[model samples]
Target chain A: MTANARANILSRLRATTTQGSFAVPDAPVIAGLALSLEERIDRLRRMLETMHAEVQVVSSSAWLGALKARLRARGLNGLLYGAETPLGAALEAAWEDDLPPLVPYSESVEQCREQLFHIDAGITTTRGAIAENGALILWPSAAEPRLMSLTPGLHIAVLEAGMIFNTFAEAIDQQAWLQEGMPTNALLISGPSKTADIELTLTFGVHGPKELVVFILT
Target chain B: MTKTADVLAFERNVTKALDDGQLRRNLRSAMTTLSQRRRALFADVEAFEKLRTQGQSIRRRALSRLPELLEQLEARCTANGIQVHWAETTAEANAICLDIIRRHGAQRVIKGKSMVSEEMHLNHFLEEQGIEALETDLGEYIIQLDGETPSHIIVPAIHKNKDQIAHLFHDRIPDAPYTEVVEELNAIARQELREKFRAGEVGVSGVNFAVAETGTLCLVENEGNGRMCTTAPPVHIALMGLEKVVEKLQDVPPLLRLLTGSATGQPITTYFNMITAPRRPGELDGPREVHLVILDNGRSSIYGDPERRATLQCIRCGACLNHCPIYTRLGGHAYGHVYPGPIGSILTPQLEGLDEAGVMASASTFCGACEEVCPVKIPFTEILRMLRNEAYARGESEHDVKGHGYRYTTVEALSWKSWALYNTSPGLARIGSQILGKLGQHLPMIGPLKEWTRTRIPPPFAPKSLHQLAQERGLDDDR
Candidate 1:
């Protein structure tokens, strides 16, 4: 029955001819003009800031301290992240001082569901950044699935400076998004969860992260 | 305006909406503010126009190859481990969704804001089957709590103000716990819906754009409910109209640009989820099973027509609703359906058949603001007129309207015919004017014209005819 319905719809649609001919325009590979990587990163930071996200660039030697200080400032005590991630390895090795519990996403969600509710923050490594829209494209893999970015109250994303692009088109084309095997989920997150539904008040943290803090690797 | 065993009286609906001063005030202020935000975003006039043109062409190109693209979408989505279903009607769609829930032995489902689900009246259907479907979007949640349909697409509860919403929360919940502060009201809903998301067995959402190339379904939202629904639940079910498919992934950005800029004046929504499939092996916390239901309720009939096919190009932005003079005044309830405003004025009649929903064709004043603000540039005013013509043709036969309705009675049509005849011939026009002048009545309480004169004073006839006065002044032009 489902196959029959599908065929019926396709047959009717195939016979359809719209009133006028339309010339299909070529989708430009890059929507905005190219800029130096430094300029692109600055623009990305500025745009993300405009969307109410906190952004900063730090040298490799100073980033871990900066990350810890920023997390403490937000009163975020416990951290949730992917254990096998490079970020995790660096933080583990850098911890000569006392630190909070680092909950690994390697645990299945059901096993960690109760603790996930109380965790102060979750962090993930972004695949790249789209500078024009201040978006972080995270392609969910087996290691870090979607919930790591969404379930927590505060979401902190780390992006390398070299991974920034001028537009989403460039990101897709440069990465060969579809040609390469893609993940089961991906997202273009601009800022924290927000809503203007109630009398047009711009309130954040409605369902997703209340605050989005980004650390750019310089 | 009351629902009575599935009978819809559009006139009564309009009267009820117009009588509520709060509804009028709420819609007026919100629509004005929304359209202003939209206008502010298009400050770059040249770039904005170019983008709209590009958006329209993308939609046209997609529609031009819809069957092929849909086939590609199904195959690619299947390859990505997403189970896709096809339904030819709203009944079939509801049944399929219910079956999926039954398979999991689930009795509770959480829903994101989906106009497709509303069109199927999915909540009511699920209730009958002893399953609870909770609306998670804040605006939709408010309307659902009140047992009402959405009054507007983007802002579903645009008809209610802060006080009313606060009252609703106080009245409906177990205890009247919160004040009417806007942020507090939002917090109340957030606190309530969070537990529903965690406990639900299945999640339902609407697809904004289904990319055929990557088999990715794009869901856009400003709030986190969309994320929670698709991410927290064990099984995810997505509903999309057949026309929502685009051929390539890159075709998305231009449309997304126009949609955000035109709809809510944002660069991009906060969350853009590209779901290629359910949870893969060794992954945590996405739906274990993903199902995509493609609905074809009355869209194929619209596709059968050539010129009317352009109606399918709409991106559901609600810009048309904001700009439409009639819709902004009447509110969405006046349309008496899930869709409202200028798009609804034409779409409902065609979908429900002209005989039943044809009165909507006459709901417009033929203003072009809807087309001017439409992101994809659907010719709404022209379509309204075509539907009116179709309504008149249908109204001519008693059989066509036997179980449905008549937009215009024969008496009204004949009255307009005689009125047109008098205006064309000067001699008859003079006699008719002389009779009205001698009667000393400014407005006539006669026939279908009474419906018009109820709210307006009929203009009195001149003391002398234009032809007569022109000849007396020696200014009559002989053509």
Candidate 2:
């Protein structure tokens, strides 16, 4: 039945007789203008901030201290981190004993579903960022899984300033996404989850993180 | 209006919708806000026009080679370990979904925002088979709780205000309290739907753009429910109309920019997800099995005609709806279809034969607001007018529009034929004008012109025709 359906549908489409090529004169790609790193960061910060996301820049060596202070200030008790990544080890080694507990995502979701949902925040290192739309491109892996940036109330994303790109196409090309084969799940997140479903009134944090705080390591 | 059973229902629904004060207020405010947001975002008119051209080119190029793209998409998806199914009709789509569910022995399914699933009526069908299907999107959840269909495509519950939603949650949700506060209502939905995401055995979602080169399904959503639906469950099923496919990954960015900017004036949605496969060996999360169902459902017939095929280029942005005068006034309910507004005016009839949904074409005033704001620049007024002709042609024309000439009646056809004859012949026209100048004022609402006069006042005729006055004034006449 499915085979016949495919055949019939394709045949009907092939039968269209009118001849006109659907081609447009090529032009420079829109949204592809190059920008300096400083301009990119400024653009990214401005766009995300308008959506209620917090963006802060800190020195590469001192960013963890800033993250700790922000988390402490917010009274977050548990911060979920990738257990297998190098950043996880660094976080573990530099942490003070009195600070919030760092929960390692060592188990499958089935084993830690409750804890995953209840954690104060989940932090992940972003693959790269898009400056044009103020988005973080996340390619989920074994260590920093898909749900680390989702599920929790607060998402703390750490990004290196150099990893930001001017546009989505540039990021895809520079990262060699098509050649490398696309990941199982890739995401471009610009802000905390939101919805305007209720009378077209915007409300934040319907099903994803209520707050998205970014720490750009300069 | 044409004298048909469905036309009467369409008129009645329009009247009923116009009478609803709350619905009118909600639609008016929402349309105003949405259009303003879009306008502000696209303030750079020249740049926006360039991007729109890019978007139009991408969609048209993909559609031109749709069959080949579908084949390539299927092959790449299969290579990535995701199963692909083809369905020619909504019924077949439903059957495929049921088969997948039964194979997994899944009793509970959670669905994200999928208009295609709504087209298939999958929720109601699954319920009859004893499987519980739940909607996880906050707006969809509210309407599902109330046992209602979506009025607007982008915002399903746009017809109801916050107060109405608060009342719905209080009455329907167990142990829920009434609250008009938007945040609290959203929190309630988030808490309720989170539980379903955890317990659901299967997840269902919609595809916004399917990249054929990489076999990737891209979903654009502001809420994370779409992510949860595809990730938290053990199995994920994605549904899309065949027109959603694009030729390459490079085609996505421009289209995405146009869609987001035009939909709600957002530079980008909160989350733009690109899924190429399910969970892999080392992945700690995401669904283990993924399936893609491509539905035809009369799209093949639409694609068979070059002129009508432009209808498939729509990205479902709803920008046209927000800009339409008729849609803003009546809201989405007046049209009474799965899809509504200007896009629906052309789409539903094409999909469901001219006889059944032909009245929708007449709903437009041809003001062209919808065409002006359309991101891809779909010639909406042209298509609407063309559909009206198709309905009246009744299969007499070469085109294969179903139920064509459904509006034709012997009396109406004869009257139009005679009217054409009398006007073309100068001798008969002069006599007709003389009669109208003498007695047109005394003419009553009768025959074909009766419906025309129902909402309109008859014009007072002058004592003489324009030609007679022109000749009396000694204007040059070739004759």
Candidate 3:
């Protein structure tokens, strides 16, 4: 049924034609996507490493200390991310105490969806990995709304060691919900929010999260 | 209406904008904010590149078969009770809009932010025709009130600071107090525009994507102003550039995703209004009459030209503006045209004529960054290069001499023998460089060289060229 739906969508798209008043490129001569899964992952990892270097990382407890240190170091308020329930608690406590704006995670995906609309940060779990591209498949369950992954300035993702797969297709295959006829909305996040908007001036954080952090736990 | 003569006059305007530190600060800050937001949103989306490729392909397909799809769209729109008008030029487009206004007896027009309208200078034309046109978008309204052209494609009043806007509002509204708060100012603008929307007899909007399959016009906006403009007024007129047509409705999702994501870094904008026609009999709210004016305005001429046609793929997300280094420093006013940044550098010359806006071609650093971030993959740098060649062909090569009075006429304008003699011979070129270097040292700050020396010193000639050095070093001796 899913395959049939996808085919229907593709056919509908192919059949539709635009006005002949403008010039469009001929069908894209797609150079084969040459990079292997491992090469893709390495490229992504390198990109992440560069991004991480720009940010000051803190343990779940040392978030406030890290924030203060980052403020002193960069002369700007740094984004905060927490790991688990304790991190959420700390963020909530910080918000109450008027520290820095910390993005909090919810147990319920629907609640996460609501929070996603107005959040400064997004926290989600990576279900699998794509080796060719350093892509993490974040399953958009009820707790992890797709918007949460988009709207925030900072994205803090928790990746359990065992859940990482080699490719997007492999990750999809592992999803029991797909076999059970459940809908899936997945996000693959790699880096911080960035735009080459000015004259190709690389500006960080326009309408989305500027910083992306992934916490890998064994 | 021909901006050919005004291109030279824009230098003085650019000088003024350059001096205004406050305006520069506002532009820099706003662009920075928008850029960062876009980057963050795209970071996690692996399919972003794929989506961009898809968008490019879809737009290309649409453009390749535009005439047929336009007919289909016209048929569908007319069947759906919408009126379609084809305009060959800006004047024709404006006149058509004015005729619609006259037919409706509309005294006032409420407009959403439409770059096409700006390109046509529709507001000024409408005011001259004795009809009041109110910009409903907050940023556009601010610029309209100031009697200024939009500085940025996405954020029209991006050059205006909060305090400046607050002051403008205080001056305009009798009882409104000055406030530095942005949200407060937005609320005030909303209040001011709401009244206009309710009283407005006609609404004018720009189409983001026109679906040929269903004759649907899609509008993506953060504010509900577009919704108000399209629905509240009795007559709604959608001004679409001929290039905005897309083949199918499904192809719209990816393009919309790219537009909103690239523009505001949101996965989707607050409102995505897709209107096929005027409200049907049972509809409670919507325009009674829908008029879609498909404006050619210099687009059809470039349609078959392979080198220039890629300009049509632009989605106008303003991502290039946000990330542009030159735009960050000089601001949009430096280009002295409606569209600015990488897109503007290539587009302005094409639409307005290369000879008319030749100076704008030099505005780029050829950074290739615009191409990198472009959702539609418009090779802005390559297009700018083409425009530069075109500009030179039209005798606008004075700017290309690298310094004042260093005319390329001796070689470029003279015989092909002169060009070949200077370009092909390595020994002669080296000797010339050596002499120039010596002269540069001896001639103490004279002529056009003075301006060149102010920012950078010309390097002395080396005994061996880099190619020679590489060859001596046992590198590939291709040179």
Candidate 4:
């Protein structure tokens, strides 16, 4: 790239950042909004039912182990059990084969970001679900880079038994728990990446991941 | 090159396409896949419809304020240090492009896929002026080498299968062997295009949408060729239709959502580059001089007619093409125009002129499927009907004689009025029907009933009319 070309790109970038032309309408921050864990889980169940997507719930440590075993049986790779396990050891264990390695758990969120750029799939916790648009929101902080959830083709998100909401408005209204500030990144993934550009012929997995798998842990 | 009437030429081409079973199969398979993908992507019915309405209204609003917006866009673009040029026709647009190339002393041009350029036949014109124009997009590069026009809008070389592509590649490349694998063919083309991208002096592309507020041009694509073409050359030129503009930046997201979803059934394309101006002093990878050529070949005239004004809402997603039954059967080449689908059936005639290209208007089943799937919600079937009416008025229709005969016999003559009066009174209508039925049975063939009887037995004239039958059955008289 020429110096002139680099200057042009930087100038355009500066102009855009300073112009504030692409600013979205600022969302209002509300206080004292809360939902019980059971209510959230139930709302999620209803939304999934409407979309004809399946949902599974697991609670016991023994059952979680069995679920991992079953996922392996179904040809899913990089299965790592993170509970009571060192984050580094789990990462190494997940990297056993040619199949995409998965981390079962991370002791620290920072470990997740280090492994994110190379991983093909990520199973992470969702802060909450918005009912209005049927979206699952994930926040990226210093511990977890935004790229981990976005770069992968398959995002297997595990929501706690009670974090789902009925609408996106409700999800936005319920963001009072953060102590420091909003995370640098938030991804609202609704479905898999798809395309129908070729002769209007639909082909999945053009650029983004072809599939999205979400699990609810009771 | 051909001076034949567009409708007559189109009819001949469509007839040939209908006979090619292989082409029909390829189109059908591709269309089916596209329709399924679109269906999956737009599962949220309410949101999808809302977006469609928004897109339609935005385009309509933009067209109403087009002249003003174009002036505004030109001013802002010029202020941003990008040169803007206006062309009233394809000839003018081509001349301006050539003049720019000549001024820069450019010998080689690498082009991204721009349908407006295709409409103007810019490649041929440029080549005539002794400049090499390379199509950098993979699909376009293949068809360029094949020496054929693009068969589809989004995917240019859609009609050709892998085997045919392999054969074409083998013939074109000196050392490359013919291969069926797609990756190998792509690699060969990639290798061939990389040199053009590196060495070309001019880069040309089509603008998906030009933001009037900030004087930004948006190019959305899955392949990286558009980026390469825009950034590789010192001189970058964009040929945009006058209709491809939106008022503000916020309007862009909704339009993008609809365009990407309708075109490829994707939420968004891989690359959505918003280019504001030419490369500034410190930019690493952008053109030094950016030129935007706004072409209004025949669109201004279209905006004047209320019946055809809705045609301007087209985002060129080609969803109507995928769902159109006639288009799937006939393929793009059969349309004998740059656009070749449901939208094409209505738009081509208007832009090219109804007297010459109106036959395409009658090609629809009026199933309303095109309108249903249209991202910008163009009332395609209704526009088609209006075009057909215009065709008939100009005596340009193949069915003109039949249409005229019907109009003369039914509308010009008052015999049908007398017949209607007789039918109004149930007793009189029944008696007349009985007489006509007796005459028909006795004299084997005669009058208006003769031709009707020759094809198949006409409905037997009943002794009792429908009203009497209804009354006898105790149904409501009004019904």
* Candidate topping lDDT: 2
Identify the candidate with maximal DockQ: 2
Candidate 4 wrong stretches, greater than 4 Å = A1-218, B1-8, B394-479
Candidate 4 deviates by what RMSD?
Answer: 12.5
- Model 1, residue pairs in steric clash: none
TM-score of each: 0.91, 0.97, 0.65, 0.64
User: For all the models shown, what interface RMSD does each have?
Assistant: 3.4, 1.8, 13.7, 14.1
List TM-score (chain A only) for every prediction.
0.90, 0.93, 0.51, 0.56
Which candidate number maximizes TM-score?
2
Q: How close is candidate 3 to the true structure, as a TM-score?
A: 0.65
The lDDT values for all models are 0.83, 0.90, 0.65, 0.66
**Interface RMSD for candidate number 3?**
13.7
Q: Tens-digit lDDT track for model 1 on B316-427? A: 9999999998888889988887889988887777777766667777788887899988888888887887776655554343212222333546776787899999999888
Let me know the TM-score candidate 1 reaches against the reference structure. Answer: 0.91
TM-score (chain B only), all candidates: 0.89, 0.98, 0.89, 0.85
Q: Which stretches of candidate 2 lie over 4 Å from their true place?
A: A17-31, A73-77, B1-3, B474-479
- Show where candidate 3 strays beyond 4 Å: A1-218, B1-15, B394-412, B415-419, B423-440, B443-448, B463-479
The CA root-mean-square deviation of candidate 3, after full C-alpha superposition on the true structure, stands at 14.2
* Tens-digit lDDT string for candidate 3 (A75-188): 223233333444445445555333344544433322333344344545555666544334555544333433445445556665554555554334545665234332222334
Q: Say which prediction, candidate 2 or candidate 3, comes out ahead on DockQ.
A: 2
> What shift in Å separates residue B436 of candidate 1 from its native position after superposition?
8.1
